[model samples]
Target chain A: MKIHENCEILSLYIDGRLDPSLKKEVDVHLLSCAECREITDRMKAAGKMLSSLEPLTAPPCLEKDVMDSLESRRSFSFIRMAPAAALFMLLVILVSYSLILPGKRNEKLTSGQNLLENEGTPPAVSGDGLPGAGSLKAPEGTSAKATTEEEERLVSGRNLMARIDNDDIKAELKDRPADRVPAASSAPALKVEEMKRCETEQGVREPEERVGMDAAGKKERPDTGASSTREKMGDMKVENRESEERMLPYISSPSKSKAALPEAEPALAGTKESGSPSPLVISNRKDFTMLWNLQNASGGLTCKLPDIDFNRQMVIAIPSNAGKTGYYIVDTVEKEDGIVVQYREMPIRDPAPTPYQIRVVNRKPGVELQKVE
Target chain B: MEKKALFEGIVREEKDKVFNLAYRLCGDFHQAHDITQETFMRAYGSFERFEGRSQLFTYLYRIACNVWKNSLRKKSFSSFTSYRLDDREIDPPAREPSPYESMRSEDRCRMVQKCLDSLPARERAIIVLRDIEGRTYEEIASILGCRLGTVKSRLARARKSLSEKVLPFMEVAGK
Candidate 1:
């Protein structure tokens, strides 16, 4: 801040060379000192004089001169830089698509084989035609993994998870057919009215009231052991593929009315009458439990149903087998009030996990899915 | 659609400021214009690297300063370009006409500029940018890649020296 120090910093001060702190000092000093003030004024005029000395313009041939110089050179063009980012994004998308989408051929083969092998009938769709042509929908049965190749593709896996749940019930029901026909498997040493009521509730025909009853009319014989149950199941004819496929559209649709629930009801009722306590028991070893939860404060669906329960449009699939897997879909809203269930138990293939994409459409109220106990 | 369109648009808009700054720093109309065109060409070549970090003007200013500085070097005009009258040449001609009334306004302006051309290249450059162009010290600092203090001090000395050379002429020109 002294005069000698101020003078050394002064020259730069006029030229904008002094730091702000030092410049502030000079500004304050120059305000009070006539000599330094005169010096500051003159320095400012000198700088201005130099700048206004010449007004410059680009020569007429400047662009031509530049272009002619540049004609022989290469690599400074604009197109070179833009393509890298675009190519990278495109590659990520193609890789994801390849990973996710499986061929139709494999899917059909899986469903076809499931029909041939899985013997357990699905949950009973009881209606007016008791045990007639009503088809069974096993919820949680997929045997597709025997042929599943590992990549990273996702199909409608939540539906597949629901089907797995139905299949578990089918496996349980198969081992204990009596569970399907509770009354016949139970003793019938009681009143006729009581027996008729039990039969009606179960959609079973009373053995005593039967006319034109052939094998369907045979009285229930209780079987305690697997061997005896096995004999009974062996004698019963397995429904052909055509019959199962023909009945699928009706039983699978959630929109079907309770009154018009597939006409195959009567025949299924007969199958139930003969089938014992869930002729199958789903063990925890082969038993895969799919726990699903999505982000909603008020309402959510847990796909732990006997069949694949697609009650809501946006569902999630957390296949323990396929860890952290999600399929992006703009789900169709529920067309009718009823729940839609599917039970295709031909070993369904677990989806490969390659093109697993999480495009978070961030909105004011974006839906979130997290793990729940 | 083509790359040239974007560059052309930039060139039309930014060429003047660039030319003026170059002219002020070099103190030669011919060299300043050349410097401006070369600055644009350099900018066009590296246009791909431009990621818009700062305003295009700031970038162009930095490029123009470098171009002017380099042209000074290429022409070996460093001694001439960087000379400060006090720091180097004081071509005093035995106390010229005492009235100081003989000089024209343009002669006074030229005399002041010729004296500024004597300062160090960077000091001369800073004076032209901050004092003459009335650029903010911060912008001058950024363009020259120096501290604000450097710009301030240099401008002060530059002004002081110019008036020493031209005040006699200014007093006359004003009368």
Candidate 2:
């Protein structure tokens, strides 16, 4: 290497970084070059002077200061996270509130549907109107204007009756079965005037009692003895009271009612009495499997078998009636001997054989069927 | 907690070497103190990134050099040019200087520091690490994040510049 190139190489040479061959080359070049030699000497002197300068001792408090700063920074970070933590909690609460509100609204809607289903008619025309009152012709001797007025009075009286509890009207009806006025008679004016009097005398009677009395009046119109009418009305009242009690628990607590609705649905669908045999109780999966296979072999069922835990529950399969299209479970009473399930039937326009009406109930040792007449 | 204890041990062990390196690089005791603190703070902040490929002191030395370089950039040229080291702020040596040798040694130290301060920051850092701090060429390369060849070339250039600035002082001391 030349003198100028050796200038850069001399730093490495002084630091002992050069190989023996290169170091020898730089040493050989240095002897012949005065300027490079002087440069190397000055560089060495500068390095020695720099090395002579003493290192400064750090302040005694530095470690303390650094740790304190780090500690403060850590605490400040936690404080900074406070708002985020609170925001997360707030988001959780809002999500839970939104989730719960929809469930309650759904329960209310289901309860409303159940009420409509059980009543079997639209809410506006349920109480004192005939089964198909909108299609019924006005009776003779009633002017169109008078018919409209009586209908209005009947509607008003129905509203008043709903406000009072059914228990009070049931008691009043029990005491005066002979004096009960028929609200579904051919004489529309007479029915309306009697309903108005009943409304004035004792608030109002339940529309169910009025409808029962009308059915009894129709059946016993030919007979002179009020005793027969009274017996029929008494049986009707007992059946109505039993049905009302069954429905009362559902209306009061919507959540449980929602769960129980599937079992109650088929029972609520019919109201007339049938002489069909008692329901077959299938308690275990083995019996259910056999029954299901038999049902499939016979032909498919009209409705799906309800899904239930066989350990906790059993299926009550009421036999299909050729004279009835649907079965309504009027009441289920658990006796020491067996469970007595009283049911009514819905008359079919065409009395064809129907599928077994299935009801899922808590597992009982034995069950008996009783027709509600 | 173990990591914190390890870091505290590092701070105790490496603080002086780092402070001395900063002191020679900037030629100001106060700025060196501040730079040393900043270096440790930055090291603690990014402690997780330290992969332990090198010694902890080498890593800390690299941070100190960076801290000094950044401080130089933030300062205006005029303020930097006008800046002077305050002798009162400098800590005394471990051993007391004799009355006779104190003035001459203090003057020589000041004059050498003044010459080091005149060089560019990169050159000054090279001279400080290799010459004053006595780090090997390979260590300087690792600390400065450069190739070994670059370290040699830069150190040559740095020593050359420092030699020119300190030549008059050396000549006067010789006389």
Candidate 3:
């Protein structure tokens, strides 16, 4: 580097500004170049003089004064921002809550309905009974579009049942037909076994027997009076309203079902006693009305079976002849272990009984009907 | 941490550097104190935005330079140079001095400060930052918000000018 060019390096070098390689280069250059040496010495002296200048001390009170001013300004700023922050937080909460509530309700409605389409049965109970109860729990086997009104009714009824004292419950259970108490004990397994039987029988049952087994079996059946099945159903509904108030207290737990199971067994064991071929058979559809004691007196058909206690009755009516139908229900019969309620495709309210459609609703949550395939 | 406590910590650590930069740039003790206060006040107002991209002292120095530059715009360089000769003789020799010796030292300091003030603002900033404040060229470039080459060239020009202006004083002292 020439004298003029080296002067830049000289100043940079004196200020420790040059890179090491350049500083060393300048150092070698300075040892030989008198003119560069003179310039470097002068630059060194000038840098020392300036760096030696005293640094000023800030006043002791300077920080306190500045901070006080800053605090006052910040308080004013916070006052301005407060309303906007509050409004933003409120909007976020409102938006989140609005978004969340319907999801919970829809979640309750949807979860179990899908299982009905897939499995054709009420969903099995999961741990939290409330959510599981909503699954496929519809009346008349129509899709589970149970109205909020029904939900509210179910909730209130459950609350009422919860209030029943244990003594009251036991007394109420005791008051039920002694034979029916064993049937209730046999309920869960009996339902499963009956459902399996019905599924098998559904394939083998002839069209004529499917219509009305009294016509096909040629067995005598007592005709239910008046052919006013609609009015009878209406009467049953009214009775259900009355009986549900009484039944709700006793039906909350499965302990009753387990207790009743052994008693129902002997009824099964005595199948030969009836000597009726299929001892559990209420195969004659006209005899179905005998299950509820709605048969005519003149017909001389006796409903001689011991009366049973149950939570609700399902009336399944299938069309048979024009404007005439057969009503079928789960018929409870004595069995070996206990009594069993058989759910078959029996017709009610119509004589033709074709297409084999059945409608059922058990208003009690705990006492769900076993789907016969 | 409370805003006051945070700001106080930064002030405690870098207050002298800020004050010295202000004093050196404007050559007025009162004005330097005022500028230092204003610099910290501005830093507090935007402290939330200070994302710590640079060192704290470097950031504070940038603010101090701007404050000093703004003060220069309001008052001319000649007025600042007039205040340069005072009781504050800038880290004078440690040995005790007679009145005449103190006066001579003050005169020399004033001469050096006058030479620094003669340079343009950009060059003056580089010289004060690099030569007086002993900041590296990279730091000088950062504080003045300029490229390293700009710091190098302007520093060279400021040094040339300073040497020319103070040469007569140095010669007189040499005799």
Compare the candidates by lDDT and give the number of the best one: 2
- C-alpha lDDT (0 to 100) for residue A354 of candidate 1: 15
Q: What would the TM-score be for candidate 3 when compared with the true structure? A: 0.41
Weakest 10 consecutive residues of candidate 3 chain A by summed lDDT: A184-193
Cα RMSD, each candidate: 21.6, 18.7, 20.0
Cα lDDT of model 1 by residue, A318-342, tens digit: 1211112222221111213211111
Assign candidate 1 its CAPRI class: acceptable
Predicted candidate 3 versus true structure: per-residue lDDT over A1-373, tens digit per residue:
5544465777777777678887787888878888778777777777777887655556677777777767777787898999999999999999997788545433322331221122222222212221111221223333323344333322221110111122222222222222212221111101122222333334322233122222212222222232243233334334333222322212222222323332332343222121111111122223333322211111112324322122442222221111111112233333233223333222222121011112233322222222221
How good is the docking of model 3, by CAPRI class? acceptable
lDDT over C-alpha atoms for residue A360 of model 2: 54
Regions of candidate 3 where Cα sits further than 4 Å from its true position: A1-6, A16-25, A71-373, B73-105
- Name the lDDT value of residue B157 in candidate 2: 90
- Which numbered prediction scores highest in TM-score against the true structure? 2
Please provide, for model 2 over B18-129, each residue's C-alpha lDDT reduced to its tens digit, 9 standing for 90 to 100: 8888888887766776788888888998999999999887899999988888887887222433323435544445556786677677787789888988988887888889
Candidate 1 scores a C-alpha RMSD against the true structure in Å of 21.6
Q: Model 1 chain A, poorest ten-residue lDDT window?
A: A290-299
Report residue A41 deviation for candidate 2 (angstroms): 0.7
Question: Model 1's chain B TM-score?
Answer: 0.75
